[model samples]
Target: MVKPNRPQFTDVEGLAAMVGHGDAFGVGGHHFARLPVALLRAITRSGVKDLHYVSWAGGLPLELLLEVDAVAEIDLCFSSLDIFGLPPKFRAAAESGAIPVRDWTALAMIQALRAAQQNLSSMPFQLPQGSDMLARMPNAIAGPDPLAGTDTGFIPPLRLDTFVVHAQRADASGNVQIIGPRALDFAMAGAARKVLVTVEEIVPVGALRQDGRQSILTRNQVSAIALAPGGAYPASCLPFYVTDYQALSEAFAAKDTVLSDKLRLPSGGLSERLQEAAKVSAETVLAMPAPAQGDKKASVDEIIAARIAAELDNESFASAGAVSPLANVAYRLAKATHAPDMIIATMSCGHLDIAPSPMVLSLIESLDCETAAAHAGGDDTYSTYYQAGAVTHEIVGAAQVDRRGRVNTIALRKPSGGLLRLPGQGGMADVANMHRDYLLYIPRHSVQSLVDGVEIASSARGLLTPAERDPMGYRTGKALVFTDLCVFRLDQTSRELIVIETMPGVTHQQIRDATGFAVTFDAGCRELPMPSGDVLAALRNRVDPLGLRRLEFVSAKERGALIAEILAADRAMLERLIAAQKSPAAS
Candidate 1:
């Protein structure tokens, strides 16, 4: 019987030490586990074999743990070799009859944790418990209410043993304080065994009470307090400081290194003051004003110039009759995989041309969006619907990803001390939840995109900072993150993102230049294809084209190329774009 007052370890190792040798902790089985890698490492170091991970872990850790002959059973939600990597342990876990696969949600897990925290046998949940996942899950029963079957037929009554949390600040008595987004930490705290709290700064008791706002985590609910400065490092959100995308990108890029190289970052090295300062720096940069450099007159001139250049390029192309490299790539992939209905995108500010070609859009438009949307069900609200349900495949993009198949799409800092903060909860979180085979798409190298740490608060679910996700159940989806030059897939067995393929023209040096993280090559890697003409045509014609005139930062060559491509699809469309470019209303 699990109870809320039980003594749990605040140290990661202690948390791991609590699980039975063969006991399996059921993480959110549909997505990635929210625990930080360091904390997870302690659990793995505990040498338990029976692990019930969510769908999003990607199997990298499972594979590594298997190598030591420690793991014996496993469970999965959906299988995507890219996010989860290639690992034999996945098969072993499946064969062991220990696999308890099911469809679950962050809400259900939170309810379970809440129940554990409340020291109750079970807590009432109101989510769609009638879904297939809870059909036969132990302890989950149909509600007695007559209206229960009207929407979802059932309710989940989850049971858990422990809930671990890390916070920005805490007193020695375990008064935790958080500085970022809160999904359901309070509910999780209410559902787990003696909650373990880790804080960046352990303040005196009086400090918390002095400010009425310090009720982030009360001391009474916490069992032990651990002073682990920088403990959150790459996994926790330190308000004001964005994540270290550079460091994380390097780890993702350098796939040949030991998995631990990607997981272990020294957390105890940084002083409390420095950590706090770094956090502030991140916030300061994010708070900075967006540039107001766009001038209407200049924008019109640039657009006209670009349009003229494109005409020349098109004439040249007419003679050469050259095929677009990107178009050809898209065609082959569509042909080889059969026609997929939708395409997934990220940070997509209403523009498909950022990376997708016209031909790709055409192919997508040909499919049935209505049908695709229906099949996608609750997960279809994202812009990228291709990867949602059974629509063939879709493309996904991520900012920072670790070997554990974890992705960071939230706050990350730039080298110049700037931050790219989302004004709202962008579609990344929704995309992660809906997409089935997420194809990560990004440039080969990111100057400040990948980092050793993440600063921004998570806008969506998957593996949120320790403070945000407590009690170990919620998870997010991460399939393959494709960059300009290479593709990183999760090893199915270990659930680690490993280099599985490289782009046709990508070189190691070029990849390094294009990426913000380290990259490795797969000896047996295959070449990824680009967009086809049909797809490109659709992308060009169907998607609205916007011209950024007087955007001084715009590259002339890129502008010319884009203009030429846009004109080739339809001269009339180009005229509209030019008109828009000339309009002051564009401002």
Candidate 2:
């Protein structure tokens, strides 16, 4: 049933030789985790041209492929560098209008892949109302549903020619094993004609069968296997390493050049070293002494986190998407303090119903799975949580939000003429209508961000009244917006954002001056309650030990130095996790 004799035993260079011009290519991993870097390096070096790259959640891999003028077209759900900021090459390319890009929503992307794997011509999906995502998404057929006479959209199958992934271990028989959080890789493999895999370890067929991790791509599905230990470096490969943020930041700084030699480490004696180091890091985290409480000045990050935590109930389903460290902190802070039973999903990886872990960088990759009650990919997550309306709250950041609650995450038309591109609308288009409480946050809110009208409505649910939503089966809840200045709640009847309370230092007059629209607040208005001792302690000492939330508040110029400091501390812990034989179970 497999294709006729795609090379079964080859190195990365040999595999790279197989990728032809204009082939639809897929790269594995979610965000900065578990990507096939060695293979990407090989592809970049090989000088293949005019390839159509498909990355459902594109990150470093997408950027790397764009280095040598290889990718002619990119079909992606989003392109970002997560906490580091925008993907430089991807952003520059989009801003310059050099290469063509097709921005797809998360759910639509998966549905397209599903159609491909299932051998269907096209897949029909429910079009989200109250947004213009469909207008921006090219190649999608949107109109009245001929069958039901309701709104609908259809996308052609994402037929991929080749796909590559990195995994913990694989056998000569081509059994690929992923230790944890196999995000979108399975769907990619299923949809592609040729599946190439690189692994951290190549084990005997018998050992591969007996390994505790799940074997996702069977021998029949895999076309080739390459042995490359620590192949997923710079990106975390679970028990092997956490994201090499220092290396990644350095690579980003280097501009368009490929820094493979400096980034990839020799795998010999690496496992033993990382295993021992991991044990030490685990002990350090577990044995960390509590900091003494005092009049330590509270940061804006802590204030926002505490305020968001206060919104949580004892038992609610909350989700923190990729690149949202503030939401990550708030959800964990809420669980560690008041809402003991809060169920949280860590990232787009779908680490569903995870136990609250410390807000460490490694926690998103290592401890997330160790502590998670269950794990699934993007498809299962949407089906079970997002589409079912089980996710009560999801806190997302916006590039531009309007008085009517519409968001612009796609791009902003510049006064000078061209587009000022943002990270493409990831899942916001679809998930905007999914969560029970459609919560949005803007870390640095000003007249520019809180606009009268957004340039592109990538996602919105501004009208959330029971009357408007009950008939559509959408969740009826408040559309709350949080910012550095104050909190604004959307008035469904009026369909406009209204001030609820100002921050402690910010006055109503300051808010009015900063806002682009009309407001109904003055100097004598209620301010958000100051975070108490317990809340501050939890934020400072207990939850966010690495200060990940501060990444959101800092300016682009300031982020490098701040990231270096945080990543250095994170590296020490990850080095230890990588050394341990059996990672200490997440608690």
In angstroms, give how far residue 530 of model 1 lies from its true place. Answer: 24
Q: RMSD (Cα, Å) of candidate 1?
A: 19.3
lDDT of each: 0.38, 0.78
Best by TM-score: 2
**Cα RMSDs, all models:** 19.3, 3.1
Worst 10 residues of 2 by lDDT: 274-283
Q: Measured by TM-score, how close is model 1 to the native structure?
A: 0.42
Q: TM-score for all predictions?
A: 0.42, 0.93
- Candidate 1 Cα outliers beyond 4 Å, as residue runs: 1-16, 22-35, 54-100, 112-144, 147-152, 210-215, 266-587
Residue 35 alpha-carbon offset, candidate 2, angstroms? 0.2
